[model samples]
Target: MTVHNYKLTVTWSGNRGTGTSGYRDYERSHVISADGKPSIPGSSDPAFRGDATRWNPEELLLASASACHKLWYLHLCADAGIVVTAYEDHAQGTMNGDRFERIVLRPRVTIAAGDRALAMRLHHQAHAQCYIAKSVNFPIDCEPSIE
Candidate 1:
């Protein structure tokens, strides 16, 4: 077993700064994000409170699963002697409800100019071996559109 970790930090400053007027304003930041760019992604929504355009942990977690799965697909294809010409994945995710909502990541993986049978097998191998997909409790589904 292996472990990976990252350090994240966020900060904010602006109108509604630490006040009870519902003006709740501040800048979000991250310590090791975008190479030390301390600006967390945030929406203009009054609910967001105010911040940058950095994806939150939940979204990032989903992305990690997608990325990891893609890499695993490539690895499995290589091991299986499948020559992949190209690959693409449109990964999307959403929260169920509440601040701690359950999230789901759906990845549609596409392959180009490869053996159909081998690609199909690699697709399954990728999903079965991806660490992030296996780790997350949420529903991480992959639609392999191998071509």
Candidate 2:
């Protein structure tokens, strides 16, 4: 079996001079950067004394799952002769205190008229094939609406 490796750098950018002197001293802001890609401004969730404007870790987790599933679904559709037009997912992740409970991927997909049953089945296949979904301990359920 072949294993692939990925790497990225996360740099803290929120030192407010004093630097973690107290509970509210330092900012929760940081930058997630990788080669040949744009940097992502990251922070803790606003509920945890973070910047509301930055992308939080919780949201990033949900996004990773959603994006992974979408890519896999599209690949399966193409291979199965299901012509896909539009695809979007409004993914929601639920957290219980500090731990994640579940993630729901509500995907709205538009396809070129074909076997609807097969199109629906591709969602299950995509779920099974998603690397991120398989890695996460929390449940990732796909609720897809094909049009």
Candidate 3:
């Protein structure tokens, strides 16, 4: 058996005290170099009790799913000799049932200068083979387009 390793570091400082007294900022300005992805939120500010700049771990649950799927899609495209000049995903998710159970990711994909059928084929391959979609418990769907 083998296991992969991952690590994360978080730092923050502000008016120390958990109350409606001052401000607390949780900004994620730095990221790991190996993947070149911003793993944390860039700006964090706690102006009130209901509004906080620090990212709640729960929010990432959905973002991770989308990001994972996007990366997988890109890799699959490359392997199939598909050139994706531009790609973007506007993912949205909802939480309910006290369990944060519903997560929906809609990825709008764009492939540059390729046959429509070929692009469609690659998109299909990307979804069928995404590892995160296989590993997580969520209803994942996509609308891949080329423009």
Candidate 4:
């Protein structure tokens, strides 16, 4: 078995002036960076006093799951001789307090020519193989429509 390791740095950048002296004293902002990659601006949910302009952990988690599934699905489609033209996913996550209850991925796909039934089936296969979906404890459901 082969294992891959990933690493990144998260530096807090929200010390307003006095630091975390009070609950609302500091901003919930940070930078996420890895070697040879662009840095990501991160913050908490806007409801939690975070900057809505920056990315939040919940959104990032949902993006990761969606991206992983998309990558796997595309690879499977390619190997199966299905020609995919366009793909877009509208993914959503439900969080009850601090824990995520579930994530739903709504992918709209446009194919030049392919088996519609097989393309739909590939979503289940993609979800089963997605690393992020496998790692997460919550359910990740894929609702895919092919055109």
lDDT of 4 by residue, 1-147 (tens): 799988999999999999999999999999999999999999999999999999999999999999999999999999888999999999999999889999999999998878989999999999999999999899999889999
1-147: candidate 3 lDDT, tens digit per residue? 679897666543333455325333322232222355565542222322322554544556667777887787788778767778877777766656445565565666666654657766665666667766677676667766666
TM-score of each model, in listed order: 0.66, 0.97, 0.64, 0.97
Worst 10 residues of 4 by lDDT: 110-119
The per-residue C-alpha lDDT of model 4 at residue 4 equals: 93
lDDT of 2 by residue, 1-36 (tens): 889999999999999999889989999999999999
| TM match of model 4 to true structure | 0.97
Q: What C-alpha lDDT do the candidate models reach, one value each?
A: 0.61, 0.95, 0.60, 0.96
lDDT of 1 at 83: 69
lDDT of 1 by residue, 1-147 (tens): 778776655433343456445443334433233555554553332345434454556556766777898789888877776767766666767664544234333444454545777777676688889887677666666666654
The TM-score measured for candidate 1 stands at 0.66
Per-residue error (Å), model 4, residue 29: 0.6
The runs of at least 3 residues in candidate 1 whose Cα sits more than 4 Å from the true structure, single-residue gaps closed, are: 2-23, 31-47, 50-52, 99-114
For all the candidates, what are their Cα RMSDs to the real structure? 4.1, 0.8, 5.2, 0.8
Candidate 4 regions exceeding 4 Å error are none
The predicted structure with the larger TM-score, 1 or 3, is 1
Q: How high is the lDDT of residue 7 in model 3?
A: 62
